[model samples]
Target: MLKGKPKYKAIRILEGCGFHAQMGLEVLEQRSLINTSPNGYLDMHDHIEEMGRNIACRLHPNEPNKRRRLCDKEEIEEVLVNDLGTKATRIMNLKNPSIHPATIIEKLRKMKALELLSVYDADRVSQNWVFDEDVQYFPDTLRSLHWTGYPASSLPKTFQANDLVNLEMTRSCISQLWEDGDRKVE
Candidate 1:
């Protein structure tokens, strides 16, 4: 843990050792001690919305925070839209078991900069759901998609994002990733 005032010299020294102290001295000074461990340290410049999304994505049912009632969807959306100007690129764990899948889909469709989407159903089983809209509604910049309990029988015909690198769907009804037989898989 870093204690005391983190002056410019201290910041530089930490940086020289491959540690980042980008939060600046004023912010660091407010904390009595800063833990530099991997899980303890977080970039101050990182959007809280993004961080919350990640937390929700990685949240385990048995985690202590879950019992404390940490899920607050409205607050997360507010920070994502108001504070970060809706600039989130990676979205994960936005689905909570209690919330309906349709609502989650609607929320995802509106994210302008969303590049990575990871969703899980808390029910532990696949539910039949369909996205009736064209795949073009999804951001072309999307690179990774992980959806648990996906309800569709096949991937959207309009899904042609060239930037996509990872796709995972568990407990899904998908029979094929695309309709075009001519498309090559590399």
Candidate 2:
């Protein structure tokens, strides 16, 4: 592991990812690191939470507390500055995920982390938002946005244009938006 604290550059990245140095023990370890240990999963959660907090703060600066709350099966997408094109800043949106691994893969392909935008699934999709695609390795700052108990695919897709503001959509509605290619800024 790292001796003492992480380097300045690393800290900057961590800060940008919404992680302070204090919450470094809650990260989830990948299967490779999970040799019958408890810290691994905790660490994973921390790291995922940090990423989610950062994304939420960036996307919705006005309400940091509301966005960073912990839970299960949360969903969000973050586009880097270089990828924004006309948009000056990056964009991040939280969304849920499918339970089945096959469905997860399908959703990942459709989300197009390599093409449309990058996607990270922490703790089975919605445990937290992470910059790393490898869900196996988790960092510190465990704070999951996932609170819903249902699977992403099970939720209904009913979020229509001009409906997001008025609608507190369930996982299904959000998934439907992505499935139908209907993120029209409602």
Candidate 3:
């Protein structure tokens, strides 16, 4: 689904979900399904790449909630604020996603199939974008989460993090990862 993304990064994300990336990548290479670029990124033919991305979306172009990837800004915002997500939405990439602080967790709980979530804080200044309510739950289905300016002090313990692999929070307010008596130490 990631068209021009670095291969290593995709492998790392997949590895978190118990996928044998190295083995699978090698097989793809052997079958000429993909190749390694000079920069070590995945290289594929144009038709092949186009076909791969379309297989999941060709059946539901009119339905944003049923698409495998959500990139439309308006639709992305709608899902965040309205909780109109479905299992088909596995990847969501958005810039400056704005969800009311109080409703953040409630909105997240509805995205049960989210595997990769990348939220860019391009507009909002890097500050404490936290909420009044302490978070009680975070999506356990995430394999990769890249959120700039993460607001919470500690990760919700209720977040199982069973499939979590890559967690990137730039200039976040997090002083601790989880509250294990270490939160207030510093």
Top-scoring candidate (TM-score) = 3
**lDDT (Cα, tens digit) per residue for candidate 3, span 3-37:** 45588887898787678988998899999988888
lDDT of all the models against the reference?
A: 0.49, 0.29, 0.70
Return the top candidate by lDDT: 3
Poorest lDDT segment (10 consecutive residues) of candidate 1: 62-71
lDDT of 3 at 29: 90
Which has the higher TM-score value, candidate number 2 or candidate number 3?
3
Clash number by candidate, in order:
0, 27, 0
Residue 16 in model 1: lDDT:
41
Give the lDDT of residue 19 in candidate 2: 60
Model 1 residue 131 CA deviation (Å) reads: 3.5
lDDT of 3: 0.70
TM-score of 1: 0.47
Candidate 3 TM-score versus the reference: 0.71
Scanning candidate 3 in windows of ten residues, the lowest lDDT window is: 177-186
Candidate 1 residue runs with Cα over 4 Å from true position: 1-89, 95-97, 134-136, 179-186
Ranking by lDDT: 3, 1, 2
Better of 1 and 3 by lDDT: 3
lDDT of 1: 0.49
